[model samples]
Target: MDKTTEEKFVTLLEENQNIVHKICRLYTNNRDQHNDLFQEITIQLWRAFPKFRGDSKFSTWMYRVGLNTAITLYRKSKRTVQTQDFDAVMFRISSEEYDDTVEQQLKLMYSAVKELNDIDKALVFLYLEDKNYSEISETLGITEVNARVKMNRVKKKLKKILNP
Candidate 1:
């Protein structure tokens, strides 16, 4: 790519890097894994940048690429030995006045989210981001109805995991 394109890409990535970081956090369990995933997603985004057609918001497109890259890597066989807990890095709430019960519940919910399959996890992430069904479907390459159905099922599944 030309320098101009490279600059543009870098600007966009910088502007929206938190999206990539969030995906990394969701898919990875440790700092090393998170960094690795972040790099991989950035590489994937760079490679696919030429084909980006401005059909959706840049952040939305970033979510699609980032989530797909994460799910793809997550589906591969586990080879890395996990040496640290993810709670400290991924779930730390820095607010001094936070409620303990709410914090614990959030941790439990995130733990349950971690246990979900790749697709289900992606759906939950998108849903939590307040993406409409159409956006979710476009991101995951599923029909809108399918996205709605899967989201409902995921909600029920999460409820079971949380309550049971």
Candidate 2:
């Protein structure tokens, strides 16, 4: 936590904030839980910063840290679950551009994702991010074949949720 490292940390966070946000959205149900996850991911990334060797793309590094944090983080208490990260970062989106049915379908899909297991959620998140099977396998230390098969299963699970 020296000043120089702090500066680099800020730069790092600024460069890859979107990865954290995407992971949060896929894994959590609401603004509060998502923000908690966002803060936790930020902290995890900062702690693991010294280990980053630039051997891979920054987004790849982000996937490792963000997914690790999300899978491992647990609630300290129900009352303390909400976090301030969302308030700290301002992202603008226009919901009005979408019609009501589209919005409803989007919400339903998010709700379905929220019900999946941790590893399944990770698969769904990667697929939603448009990551290739090879990239996801590298990030998760699995074979590309396994990644594709799991993605298929996650897709079927989500489809069942939407239909049921």
Candidate 3:
């Protein structure tokens, strides 16, 4: 709450904001929704900053808070039964750099990812971010073994969705 703490929070948020953006991208279907989720996550993080005891890495803590915020929003939105098309260009891959085949594959993969349940989506997001099983378990409050099991299930699920 003090100036020093506020400064530290700003610095940390600036350094790790990509983590927040990635989570938002996975959870929201539009630019407006993405910005709303990002702002809400920032508010949640700021509110919880005072209680952050540093028991885990700052980035790890950010992941926990960010994912929880996203999941909560996702559940609330689902209760309203609103459905939107997946943004196929979410990754903004340039066609100049990659061939149409690769771009199409990425789009299909992202579309499949969007179809996953909230927890499964979080698992895939964390996996893509290169988080180890321990970190994924810690972030999602599951055992490492459970994380592995869920991730395997999620992968197969994505495969089925993409192929079917």
- Full-model lDDT, candidate 3: 0.79
Model 1 agreement with the true structure over 50-95: per-residue lDDT tens digits: 9999999898999999998887777763624223233332222121
**147, model 2: CA deviation in Å?**
0.1
For residues 1-164, write the lDDT of model 2, one tens digit per residue.
67787676677677668778777766665667766777777766766888889888778879988887777664344323444344543333222121234346567777888788878777777877888988888788789999999888888988898898
TM-score of each: 0.82, 0.75, 0.83
Looking at model 3, the pairs that clash are none
Model 3 bad stretches (over 4 Å):
79-105
Q: How many backbone clashes does candidate 1 have?
A: 0
lDDT preference between candidates 1 and 2, better one:
1
Residue 85 miss distance in model 3 (angstroms): 28
Predicted structure 2, TM vs. truth: 0.75
Query: Which candidate tops TM-score?
Result: 3
Q: What is the alpha-carbon lDDT for the whole of candidate 1?
A: 0.78
